[model samples]
Structures are given as structure tokens and as C-alpha cells.
Target: MNNSHLELLKKLADEFQPRTDVNTRATVEAESTDAFATLVDLARDMQNRLDQQQNRIRQLEQMVETDELTGLYNRRGFLRRVRETMARAARHPENGILVIADLDGFKLINDHHGHAAGDAILRHFGQNLRTHTRADDFVARFGGDEFAILLVGSIPEVAERRISDLEKATSRFPLIWQGAALPIRASFGFTVYNGKSDITQLLQQADDAMYANKHAKRPHSESSHNAA
Candidate 1:
């Protein structure tokens, strides 16, 4: 029940109680019976309000953990799950894998197109990730153009393969903006956590791997100019 309703009920009950020992011993009258009935009605109303308040609280909690834009878990929600997964992994070892991914040339897409297009790309990416992953997997938008996925009961190899599959699926999905097809791609890096490692360190390793992938794919100045 909501605090306001509970407080009101308490106030009414306090006020209705006999103020003295002599009053408590007096015989009940029709007016007194009517007042008791009113109190019963008030109590029922208060109970209903309390039930509504509880339902509202659950909805608010869900919204807090979800991302409004991409419809995925936001950064705050993602970290909360990470902590929970880490705790579970500590107890069951080798049961969790963390993958970090970022869109390739996302800046170029934003610069060439616009923020609106960028947003569409992010939304599509999120949808694809959700579609390809298992129900037990946790996927979230870590930040702009960056996403993280936690695979429960998965090894690094399996996680990598899942990421690769997602990449291929995403590449095949064309984004139509302003009646034009925009090509999209992503790079991913992952590491397996066995419950013994710090969450921060594991994330860093994945991040490092991602950067290595990006650097390896980047063209040298000569190659760039030649292409131009």
C-alpha cells in the first residue's frame, strides 16, 4: 500500500478509538455502528490503493533497467547484470563470457548521413543482436555505437562464433533511409571470465581486443590515398 493511504488509515483508526477507559465501557449505539462501517469502507479503499502502488513500482523498476532508444538494457542496467553474473561465476566458475562490440566506420556514417540515420542504424543493430542471441544472454548498449553481450554458460570460442554470426547477419540486413540503402558493419572482441578475474580487467581485455581488430582492419595512409 502507498504511504499516504496507510497513513490515512492509521489516522482514522487512531481518531475512532475510545479516548478514555470510561468511553471504552459505554454501550455501542447506531451512530457508532455507522462510523465502524465507514471505517471498513475506508480500509478497503486503502488496500486497493496499496495494490495499485505496488504494480506501479514494478513498472518503474523495469523502465529504469531498460534503454528507451534501442529497447535494450542501458549502461546502468548492463553493469547491474554484470555484477550479478560475476557473482554467479565465482560460485560456478567458467560459466560466463563477455563480448564487446563497436560499429565499424560509424563516425563516417554519421558524418556522411546524419544523426537520424545513426539512430536508425543503432536501433537495427540492437534488434539484430536480440534476434540472434539466446534467451539467457544479456545484451545491452554500453554507450554510443558500442554494445556488450554477456553469454551465460558460454565459452570464449562459442561467444566469438555467435558474434561472427551476428556480424554476418547484420551485414546482410540493409538499412533504408531516405529511400537509400546504407551498408553497415561491426567489429567484436570477447573474453571468457571464470569467476576468478575482476570484472573491470575482463572488460579491459575485451576492449583491447576490439581495438586490435580495428587497427588491423584500418588501411595505411598509402593504401587510403591509392583507393582515393
Candidate 2:
């Protein structure tokens, strides 16, 4: 309890003692009951305020952990979740996969269109991944055109198939803005997590694989500005 609550309680206790000088009277008993009721009211009010404060704190935490544009977990929030997952994995045996994805020709879309269009594309892409993934999976936007997925308890074959399906599904859905259909194509690369490697190493491995995948697609690509 705060000092104010303690002080108010003490004051009430001191002021509302059963009146010994005017005891054996109905008025004195009523006065004592009123004083108890006041204490109860004050305690209830304090508890309500504490609950409101806690709820506000949770809201602030969520805002800080979320990306403003995509409404997905930002890098900080993703990292925190990854750390917690990794720690749990250390204690228990588990298998997971971390995939890093980057939108192909994202800059060209922004250049040909506008930032508004870019924002829409990001939101669409994020929503696509969110709706497709399982409840236990984690999806995050790591700023700009970079996004990630953490597939918990996934086998290598299943994870690969899932990523392939997601890539095809995302490409089929185009964001229509101002009567223009902006196609979304993304390159994804993933690495397995088996409760061993450090976070830095895992991230670097996934990043390298993502770049490699992007490069592999460039040879077969027609135009980088096709999205616009």
C-alpha cells in the first residue's frame, strides 16, 4: 500500500474508535459501522486504481513492442520472444526453424509508386503471413522490407513445404491501389534451430541464406520493377 493509503487508514482508525464515553447507544454503533464502510470503500478504490495502472502499463508495453506500420512485432519484440524460446529449448529438447524473408523489388515499388503504396504492401504481406501461419508460429516485421517467421516444433521437410506454400500464396495475392495491382514476390531462406546455436549465429545463418536465395532468383527474373 502507498503512504497515502496507510496514512488515511491510520487516521480513520484513530478517529473512528467505538465511542467509549458515549457507549451503549444505537447512534454510536451506527457511527462505528459507517467508519468501517469508509475504510472498505477506500480499499476498493485503491485496488481499482492499481488494476487500471497495470492495464495501462501492459498497453504501453505492447505499443513499444509493435511495429507502427505493420502492426507486427518489431525487432525488439521478436528478439525477446526468440530469447525466451531459446531458453526454454535449452531446458527441453525441441526443434524449430527460423526463416528470414525480404520482398523482391520492394525499392522499385516505392520508387515507381509512393511510400503509401509501400506501406500498404507491407501491411498486406504481414497480414498474409499472419493468416497463413499456425497459432504457435511467430511472425514479425524487422523494419523496412525484412520479415521473419519462427516455426515452432517443425520438421525440416514440413518447414520447407510450408515456406514454399507461403511463397506461392503470397505471390498470388496482389494489393490493388488506385486501380493498379501491385504484385508481391518475396525471397525466403531458413535455418534450423535445435537448441544449440547462439542467437547471433542463427540470425546470421538465416540472413546469409536469404541473400543467397534472392541472388539465385535474380538469374531467372525478368524485370525488377515488375511489381510497380
Candidate 3:
């Protein structure tokens, strides 16, 4: 993770260096069967330590990137990957879509059902959504009840289909709690990324559009209510 850690690894690996003595007798003694066996055990121990440390490092990195509730990338992890995508897009021909989807009536879910139920639903949705996307796609919990998806190297039609598929996937089953089934709905906005702005700005644009789309839907309900 850092220069010091890397140096430690190198040091661990270099611990089994051959004994370099000018005396032929000393060299023969060092290379004896017993000495060889001891060196082998030391080498094995070093390898075991390296493996353990590497595994710990990987776990720490995952914790840094992952959202505790959903096991999806948090905003930090998402933006880190976004910067990579942006850099790639800058150098080559790129076709990508950024979709920001915010849960509708998420506050009601928390208020009515309690935070535990809300958390259960979020975890279920995250797992369900994982089944619907590709391996290379970037899926993240942006914050709160908002999720973001980056469809890399995809056309508008592909993006559109993916969105439709995702919506359908979520709607397929209501979130079941105890004996009750609760519906979950989300408002989504998607746009093609042209590398016109930085990663953060691009995300903001998608988010703005998502809210706009959400607001746009409110009028119909208002009109229906007003008519009644």
C-alpha cells in the first residue's frame, strides 16, 4: 500500500539470501543438509507471512472501497474508478453512460418501516442489481438511497436497455418483511459521457437529471389529484 510496506515485502523475500563467505570450509558447512533444511523452513515461514500480510492488505483495501450496508462501492470507490475511466476515455474513442438512480419515497420507507427494514431492502436491491449487470460495469451506492451505474463502452441503445432491465429486475419482487411485501421504486437519469468535464461534474450532471426526471413525474399525480 505504501513504499514502506513494499520495502518490508522485499525484505521478507530477501531474508533467505545465500551465506557469502570466502572460506571454502565455512561455505561447505553452510550448504550441509541440516543447514539446507533450516533454510527451507525459514523460506516457508517467510512465504507464509507474506501470504498473510497480502491477504490483510487486500481486506483493508476492500473495506476502504466498499459500503458496509450494501457491499457495493461507496462514493470514494466509485469516483476512484471514474477517474480511471475518464483517463481512458481521454486517450481513446469512448462510449459510456452514467446513470444516477434515486429511490422514490425512501424517507417514507424509513419513517414507516424503520431503518432496519430500509437497510434490508437496500441490501436486497444491491444484491439483485448485481445479478443484472455485467462484470465490467461499475455499480455503486453513491450515498443514502442513491445508486450510480457506469456503463463503459456502451452505446445509447445498450444503456437504454440496461436501464430498462435494471428497473424490471428491481420491480420483479417486492421487499418482503415478516408477512408484508413492500414495493420499491426508483427514478433514474442517464447520459452519455463525452469526457467534456471531470468525473465529479459528470456525476453531478447525471444526478441533476435524475432529480429533474423525478420532479417531472410529480405533475401527473398533482393533476390527477386536482381533477378529483
Q: Which candidate is the best by lDDT?
A: 2
Give one digit per residue, the lDDT tens place, for model 1 in 70-155: 99999888888888888887887757778888888787778889999999999999999999999989999999999999888897
- Please give the range of 10 consecutive residues that has the lowest summed lDDT in model 1: 219-228
Q: Write the per-residue lDDT of candidate 3 for residues 1-228, one digit (tens) a residue.
A: 999999999998778655454476676876796788999999999999999999999899889999999999998898888888888888886869998988777777888899999998888888767778889989899888889888888878988888888888888868998788988777788878865556667777888888887777676545432211
Off by over 4 Å in 2: 1-32, 220-228
As for candidate 1, its clashing pairs are 1-50
- Give the candidate order by descending TM-score: 2, 3, 1
Question: What TM-score would every model get versus the actual structure?
Answer: 0.75, 0.82, 0.77
- lDDT tens digits, residue span 48-77, model 2: 999999999999999998999988899998
- Superior by lDDT: candidate 1 or candidate 2: 2
Please list the C-alpha lDDT of all candidates, in the order they appear: 0.85, 0.89, 0.83
For model 1, what is the error of residue 226's alpha carbon versus the real structure, in angstroms, after optimal superposition? 16
The predicted structure with the larger TM-score, 1 or 2, is 2
